[model samples]
Each structure stands twice: as structure tokens, then as C-alpha cells.
Target: MKDKFEEAKPILTTLMAAGHQAFFVGGAVRDYLLGRESGDVDIATSARPEQVQALFQKVIPVGIEHGTVMVRHCGESYEVTTFRVEGEYSDFRHPDHVSFTSSIEEDLSRRDFTINAIAMDVEGGIVDPYHGQQDLRQQVLNTVRDASQRFLEDPLRMMRAARFVSQLGFRLSPNTKEALTTSRELLKEIAVERIAVEMEKLIAGRYVQEGVELLVESGLVHELPIFRNRNNLVPVLESVTSRPLQDMASFLSLLVHYSTIDVKTFMTEWKLSKATKNKAHTLLDGLERLSCDPLPYVLYRVGEELLDSFRELMDSVGYDQLHPKTSVGKLFKELPIKSRADLAVDGKDIKELFPDEKPGPWIQNLLNDIEYHVLLGQLQNDRNTIREWVIEWNPHDPS
Candidate 1:
């Protein structure tokens, strides 16, 4: 299990051999202790950013000003940050200034949560100045210092606290929860992009329902209109927990079942990109149709991309129990029509056949008829057959 840590050992050993103190820190250490695979290994070192860059041949000054440098080795990148203490935070997002220090304990004291403050030396073992292991054993999240002061330093930490609770399935200490509730309004002082990232993580966490309930309880939902009445999200949480969804679009679609806001309004509130909004809406629209009896027309209209999304939603919503009559699993396997592009004819063919006739509703009507014929297997999807049908058909004459 620890073999995975071997990849990062060389980098850590290299820095430490150069008369610098380096240790694995932050979420990676927390995850390692939780018996989960850590995605990224972050190293905290007493060396300054310039010293870190000089120690590694390939270095990226990603956040050098904030005492962070990216070191790449063996086709992987690790964020190596100097042990630094932050000054006062007036803007509620960034520190007014940071002073690099040589003590890892001082650096860990300024962290947001106790669990994240623990650091592990490659050979010397764990350095837990804040008793983070105790909190991890108790399944509690507490700030390293005063919760209010920590939140005031960077308001995003409040959201991060809630997100970590969701991610780790831990309860926030009483003081931490109170601090988050009191400082909820300060979330506005943070950037929308940062808030959105944390919100998405919160929603996707294993204990999402608990996280959202905390958001409402802390009055954080009121500051962001998109999250207002998010208490109604209980059903959404229930639907998604059955099957874990990693894609953001699928997760947002599940919320549509609980939200009355239009896609545009929801996206505007969350500051989501146009592509994300479109995909989420399409997934929601497909799920709504999935509630009805399986329809070839619906399948045809929704096509493959949305059909896959609907399948994921069905699995999430307990499709086996909730939709026994609806054979989503089977229907998904046999999608009748994949897309409009798969149709044999085009607008140009329709225009050529009816050159004398003006382009109008009749053209669409003929195309619909052809699509129906193809869907019903009554006609082969060939240009000749569709063109012949168009030639024989009379728009003004009734059948």
C-alpha cells in the first residue's frame, strides 16, 4: 500500500539531502492515513522558493510569491512550498503578506484544519504539532487555531471546512461550525471560481447530503441564491449516493429535479461555463423524459450522449427499484436513432426536390415523415428512398 509513496520519495530525499527539511504534507498525508490513494503529494520544506528551484533541475514557479514552487521528476509534478507564516488578511482572500520561516511547526499552526496540518517526514516519521491524528480518530474537524480568525484570514477556508467534512465524512467541531455560520457572509468576499470549485467538491463528496445540510444550517446558502432552499436537495443527495457520479454535468443535472430555476439562471448563479450549462440541461431534459415509459421518439431525440447521461441518472436514482417498468438498461443498449446527422437526407436535398416550392413548414414536415419512416424501420436510410418519397408526396393534398 505504501509502495505508491515510492514515486515521491526521490524528490523528498533529494531536497532533504541538500540540508533542507522536507516532509509530505496537507491532503496527501491525510488521505494516506485514511487508507485512500493520495492523488498529489505536496511537500513542505524549510527551504525558500528560490532554494527549492535550485535544488530541482525542472522547476515551475507556479506560486513563487506565495512561497510555492512546482518540482517535476520522473514524469510527475509535486508542489513544494516553503514553511511560511502569513500576515493579516484584509481582503478576506489573500494574505497581506507572507514571511518565510524555518520552523515547520509555525507553518502548520497557520493551516485551516487540524487533519491537514499533520506532516510526515520521509524517514523521521509524522510531525503532528496540532494533534491531527487525534481529531482523525475522533472523526472531527477542528481549526488549528481560533476558527473565527482562521476564517477571517481567508473566507474560502469556511467553505473548505464544510467541503472537508463532506469529503472525509467527519463532523466539524462546535466552535468550527459556529465560526463557519458566523462567517458565512464573508463567502461573498471570495471569488466565484474558488467558491464554485469548493461547492462542486462538496456536492460530489461521499456525504454530500450532510455537507449541504450544513450549508443551509450555517446560513451560507442565503448568500448564494443558487443554493437557497438547498434543503430540498435531500432527494437529490439520495438519488446520487446510490451511484457515485464524478462528472460535474451529471451532478448538476440531478439538482434540476430539486430546483425550479431555469438552466440559464442556475448557470448564471454558479458562474458555470456555457458548455457545462448546455450539457447539464441536456442531461436534465433526458432524465425528465426517462420518468415516462420508454419512448423511441424520446430516445431518438435525446440521442446517445444524453442517453448515456440518463442511464447514469437512472442508476443514481435507484433505477432498479424506482423504475422497474422502464427498461433503461435495455433501451440504452438499443438506442434506435443515434443522431440527426445519421439521417440520410439534408436541407439541400429537400430544396432540390421542391425547387419551385418556397422553403417553409412543409420541408420540416417532410423531414419528420422521413425520420419517422426510418425510425419505424419502414424505410431504409438511403437518399434515393427519401428523395422518392419527397417526389411522390403532396404537401397540400390530404391522405
Candidate 2:
């Protein structure tokens, strides 16, 4: 958004007034050129990290060693980094060392891709050193330099390359594609967490099928954790053409549905958060039950919060046919209760009904039956009605 640039313009002007060259750079500039809404603005300046910190009142030395600091100006944060060149990448992740430079061209040259190498000055002047704009015009992704050398420096770029295909709906240059295939094995050197971040974006991108096909064709899928050595599952992933995955949970649910891998294994291998794993498991449960369970029961099981995610997952995997005649939203709307907290009676009330029995699983079991009946419209949710109904209720013989 231009508002973001407007908020960040003062930072550029400040650095420039201090006799340093500063410009709007990276993804924001790239997105601006493509007429897409950009996220946070990143600034590349000839000012050193210390100079940046000195120029700003509320500066955070988040990655000062890497020549980056968070400049809080006008109630907005921008990543202001010194123009620098990186040395060899021994670990295939971070550069062995970084040295500040005065030339934006040298700094841009170290970028991963040409599309991300363009820069825009504070007054809207363009710096097209690498012809990144031309590459963007062609809708092709190319490494800043030699593809193999750039990949060797950081194998994560290969994943980023594939991710860009999905995000921008762009094709990979011939040389870039060939280098990605030859250097696919180098992905093992990359951390799974980093790979997972890129993979999530790729799966959720607009051109997701193109990204997945790149992984399969380049043999890069073999280097990944769950999909590794599972060439047969390519068709399963490629089958996701109807829509992009909603999130990591949906992606995992789709893959686990077709693969022999369990949800836990997928979660652990992908290094996903516990919450994501739980959601994926819930989605899988909903999918299985949707096939055989009644609509009300499914709505009760999935709850309103997951109703949308459930529908999206079902649609992504072509399981929408399971309830062709029923509307999931309408079913949810017609439900008497959405969750246990919405119940008119609590465990205490159920416990009081059976004074002779100790508080145990029966309380929950009875509540479950009550919830089921209430959802089926056989019992009213009114507290007094339920209180009277419990007197004649028999969990053992409800019929």
C-alpha cells in the first residue's frame, strides 16, 4: 500500500539528509511495480547499521550484525539495512560474513532473485542495475547471477523460486529451472523450518499446481520430509487444482488423506506448531465423519469455528459431493447449540440429577447425549425444560 510507503518516506528522507543514499527496496518495490498491495516496507541505505540507529530515536538492533535494524518512525516499523555484500555461505544458509558497502548495485547483486533486486529512491527515481524490471515484465524468475552458484549459497532459494511461481504466477527461466533440478539435493542442507515456511506459501499461492509440479519435476520433493521419496503422492498434490490450500493445516490434511503418513508424523516432520497439527487432525476427523454422519451431527462435531475451514478442506479435496443436498452453513445456523459452553445446564446440574451416582464419565456421557438430542431438536435448550426432562431421562435406554 502507498500508505505504508508514505509512513516510511520520512525514514528514507532522514537517511538521505544525513548524507546517505536510501531507497525503497525488496518485495515492497517489486509488488509496487506489479500493482499489487505490499506488506511492510524495507529500506536499503548506504548508512551503516550504527548510522541508522543513530539517526532514529526508536531503533531496534534486531539484526545489526547482518546490517539491519528496525526503525520505528511515525508509529510504523521499517527494516532499514545497510547496503552490504555477503561472503561465502559455508552452512548454505547465512553468509559467512557481511561487509557494508556504499553501492546499491553491489548490495542488490547479492539478492536471491532479479525481481527482488530492483530499488526505488525516496523521490520515486528507479535504479535498474540488474534489469529486474525487464525480468518482471517477462514474468520469469531468474537468479541474480548464475543459478547454481546462487543456489549453492543458499538452497532455500530453490524453494523460494518455486514459491514465486505460485505467488506471482510466473515461469522459471530455463537456466533457473535446470539449475533447480541439478541442485535439488542441496535442499537437505537447509533447515526444515525454513523449507516449511516457503512450502506453506507455495501451497497457498494462486498458482499452487505450478509450484507443486516444479517440486516434483525438479526432484526437490524427495529432499523434503513427508513428501520425501514419496513420488507416488505427486498425483495427490497435483490433484489440488480446484483451489489453493487455505493454510498449513489444510495442506497437511490433504496430504495425509492420500499418503500412508500419519498426521503426527507429518506434523513432526514439517516442524509445524501444535495448534496447526490439532487443526489438521480435526479436519481429517470431520472429513471422515462427513461421509457417513448426519449433517447436524457433523456440524456438532466440527463446531462453527471450524465450519469454514472444514468446507474449504472438503472442497479442496473434491469431497463437496458428500453433502450435495445439504448446506453446511445452513446446517450450522439451524443447530441449537454450537459448543458445550452454550449448554443451558452445566455438569453440576447433571450431577445433581443423579445423587446416588458419583461424578464420573456418566456426567459427560449424559451431557453428550443431551447435546446430541438438543441438536436434533428433540429437546429444548431451556434450562427449566432440560431440568424437567432429566427427571425422566435414561441414558441407558433413550429410545
Q: In order, what lDDT does every prediction score? A: 0.78, 0.87
Q: Which candidate number has the best lDDT? A: 2
Looking at model 2, report the run of 10 residues with the lowest lDDT sum. Answer: 390-399
lDDT for position 170 in model 1 = 93
lDDT measured at residue 349 in model 1 versus the true structure, 0 to 100: 83
lDDT of 1 by residue, 208-267 (tens): 767766776888767654655565654444555444455567777876765565677777
115-140 per-residue lDDT for model 2 (tens digits): 99999997788897889999999999
Instruction: Tell me the spans in candidate 2 whose CA falls farther than 4 Å from its real position.
Output: 319-330, 393-399
TM of each candidate vs. truth: 0.86, 0.94
Instruction: Return the number of clashes found in candidate 1.
Output: 0
